[model samples]
Target: MTLEDWGWSPFFAKQFRTWQSRGLIPARVIRGEKNYFRVWSENGELTVRFAGKIRHRADGRADLPVVGDWVAIESQPGRRGLIHALLERKSSFARNLPGRRKGKGRERIEQQVIAANVDLILIVCGLDRDYNLRRIERYLTLVSGSGAEALVVLNKADLCADPQYYQHEVEGIAGKSVVQLCMAKDPEQLDFLFDYLQPGKTLALLGSSGVGKSTILNGLLGEQRQKIGAVSDAVGKGRHTTTHRELFLLPLGGILMDNPGMRELHLWGEEEDLSESFTDIEELAIGCKFSDCAHKSEPGCAVRVSVENGNLSSSRLENYHKLKDELTNLHRRR
Candidate 1:
């Protein structure tokens, strides 16, 4: 397969100029294992590990290679190679990881890079017990800083009495992002997803466990490529069927990455990043009396006023404040 089939474009091509003269070939990381990674290059798929200098030079985890990152590799014997360098990413998404305690009474915050160079992120939510507006808000906020576009996919429409109602609620919160509803069990219901797929683009699935992420992947792939697990009837939650992150090339077009369902997603960027995901509140904040007005208990707060005037949902505002405060606290600690 050519590099374009794996989401390579002029953006990445420009960054790879320096590595071209060298013997190293550019490769996209498809799967990460315990001590090595599986990558695809012009020479075909190869099992590789990064050079020690690559790890020693990395300042943190975000600087290291992750699935979907294009890297410079030197081929070795037996379809094996060494990742000599990690090319710059055109788009990436990360979350705040609670790190070990640093000193007295405090823990450090670290960024965990989820995926790199993704063109789109599918925020999947099930209509069953997995449906949560607040959780969806959190996911959108997490996707805001990533250069990739976000699409809210509400799966399991069969489980919801009126999936359109939830879709509308999501559209209100999605801002410029699109919201789609589908029953992953039926392959036809997923036709809308293909419109966004293109040969040189990469899309990723993000959601909590048991949210039909695998079902959607299987449906789109036209095969049971991923193992599907049953959701617990007692807890109304899905088991961890997918344990790792991996990339797959679609037969029709586009590149898709299926990730292990995330139970908790923490905001990792600056508080200002909220403006993109919470555009409604940010637009209303423009009319606030004070420039530094915090939506809470402030006089002439247009955001809270909208909630009172029925222009915006109280729950959405509450989640905005919750996420804002969480990011503020995280930045303060940093």
Candidate 2:
């Protein structure tokens, strides 16, 4: 198979030129295990090991190859794959490591790498009791900060008697971009989401457990390629179905990655991304009396005025401030 057949482009070709001179082969990592990976090359799928130097040079887990990383590999005449170097990434989605004990005694807090080189982030939220606008805002902040476009997908729409109500809620947070509302089990409602499936683009689905991420992937694939687990009928929550990050090429074009649902998503110092995700709030803040207005009890604060007048939901503004504070704290800690 040629590089084009493997989704290589001029941008990747230019980066590969230097590695080519070093007698290395170029490949894209399709899936990653603990220390090993499965890469797609001209020779087909190959199980790969990281070069010792590459592994030693890594500072933490984020330095390793992820599902969508393009890498330079050392391939012999009849060998599998050997990853030599990681090419510069186009974009990445990441979050702070959770479960750390609080206090100054903590030495280091690691950043978990979710995915790399993704073009779009599909934030899936089930329309059942699992749906939360604040959670959607959190995902939006992470995606926007990652420097990738974000689209909100309200899965399990069939269960909701008033899907339009939730659709409007998501639209208030997701500006301009299409907010998809559909049942993970219905293809008819999924047709509206096909506009994002253009060739050469890579999209990643992210959400909490029982949000039907795997179900949505199965729906898009038109078959049950991914394992679907049953959600709890008592609590209306889904069990974690996908255990690893793996990329799949859609028959309709584009690539999709299914990742395990994360229970913790601490921010990673993305102040600008937070601003972008809450564009409505940012725009209103510009008209505040002071450039440095805190928007809390500040005289003539446009943000406060909007909230008081009901132009902006008080809950949304509260969430925005909460996220901004989180970003600030994370930045300082970093």
Candidate 3:
């Protein structure tokens, strides 16, 4: 497929003008492995690596090219392509890097970009034993600042006795985000997803392992393109079916990215974005007596009153405070 057919648009076309003037070719990263990448350009698929200057200029892992990223490359005959620069991303989904140790007592918070230039983030959740409202809230918080629209996909609906109940509950928590219910094995139930899968758009599937990301992707592709794994009875979790993130071209004309289930989604965003994710709590805080009320022991606190009056779920409030504290700590660590 051509670059445009792979979800490229005027946003990237304009960014590549300067590199084009220098005779560099524009390529979109379809998959990334270690330091090497597989990109789609005018010349078709090519193995590419980051140029030395590009690597030197990158602040950290977040600056590097990822799946769905567009880059300027210099192709060599019978050799690997050199990626000189990464075009500015129209949208990016990232999370705090996991398992980094403090070298000397300095806590450094680093970010890892999940996907670049995605138009929509499919926050997939299984309705079986894996479904949890708190987990969905965490995913929403992680996607709130991602520039892309977040769409919640409640997969495994056939397994749930009352799918509509779960769907409505998620919609209540998701606010402006759209929520859809479907069983990946059932093609008819998956039709609601097509409205957001317009041609030229990119959608990333994200959820915990065994949440049916691979199954959903295969259903959309009308084939077993992604390997599916069976869930274990002991742990009640699905095996890590998808080892890495890969982009696919849908037959109906859209870009789909299937990502490995994220076991931990450490948030990486501004503290203010939390309000956007938790509008219900944010709205309650406005009626608080103190403008800077901590919502803990302050007087005239609408938030605490809501919890006491059974208007707000205590678990939701608890998670909001937990995430807010996490973001505050992340900032200080950085």
Candidate 4:
């Protein structure tokens, strides 16, 4: 098939030209397994392994080719390709390794790439009992820092008694760029999200389990490519649904990467995203008496005054400060 048929564009063509001059073939990694990958090349889908030079040059786990990565491959007649080099990533969403303690004898905070070069991140949160504004804020910070636009998708809207109330709550947090209040069971509601599915654009779905991410994928693909599990009504939670990350091309256009739900999203380094997500608080601080006011127990602090005067929720301000401290700590370590 031609490159256009596989969603290749001028951007990829230019990258491919540079690699071709260096006697390397261009391929897109379709799937990643342990120590191997399935790449889509000019010829067809070929299983591939990393070359010794590529393996030796890796800094850590982040150096490997993940789903949505464009790589340079060495091809041979009637044989699988060998990945030589990974192209520079346009964007990536990642997090620090969990259970990584701080201070002396601390384990290395490994970076796990969730997806690469994505244009949009759909932060799916179920309307049942799994919805948490704090969690959504965490995702917003991560996506904003990853250089991708974030859209909050509150799925299972049909299950809610008053969806508009919850929708307003999300709007209050997300501000602008809020996409749709969708029910994963309905196909018509899912079409609103299709506008972002233009050719060559890639999207990644991320959230906790039982948010109906797989059901949304089924609606978009018009088939059940991902397995959907039943959530327990007694507890209002789902069994760990997706166990892996996989990418699939939409029939209309664009690509979608479904990832396993993450219970914990420890911030790695996203100070800019935090500032962007909490722009109101940042703007409020500009009028403070001191430039470096802590906004807590500081004289003439506009932010603290706002919270005391009911202009801002105390809980919201608390969460913002918590995330700010996390970002500062992450920067110091880096």
Point to the candidate with the largest TM-score. Answer: 1
10 residues in a row with least lDDT, candidate 1: 99-108
Model 3 lDDT per residue over 107-209, tens place: 4678989988999999999999999999889888888888988999998888899999999999989989988988888866678888888778999999999
Better of 3 and 4 by lDDT: 3
For candidate 2, what is the lDDT? 0.84
Ranked by lDDT from best down, the candidates are 1, 3, 2, 4
At residue 268, what lDDT does model 4 achieve?
Answer: 67
Output the lDDT of residue 125, model 3.
Answer: 92
lDDT for position 238 in model 1 = 84
Q: Residue 96 lDDT in model 4?
A: 77
**Pairs that clash in candidate 4:** none
lDDT of each: 0.90, 0.84, 0.89, 0.82
- Judged by lDDT, which candidate is best? 1
TM-score of 1: 0.97
Candidate 2 regions with alpha-carbon error over 4 angstroms: 76-79, 101-107
lDDT for 321 (candidate 4): 85
- Backbone clash count for every predicted candidate, in the order shown: 0, 1, 0, 0
C-alpha lDDT of residue 83 in model 2: 91
- Give each prediction's root-mean-square deviation over alpha carbons: 1.4, 2.1, 1.5, 2.3
TM-scores of all candidate predictions against the true structure = 0.97, 0.94, 0.96, 0.93
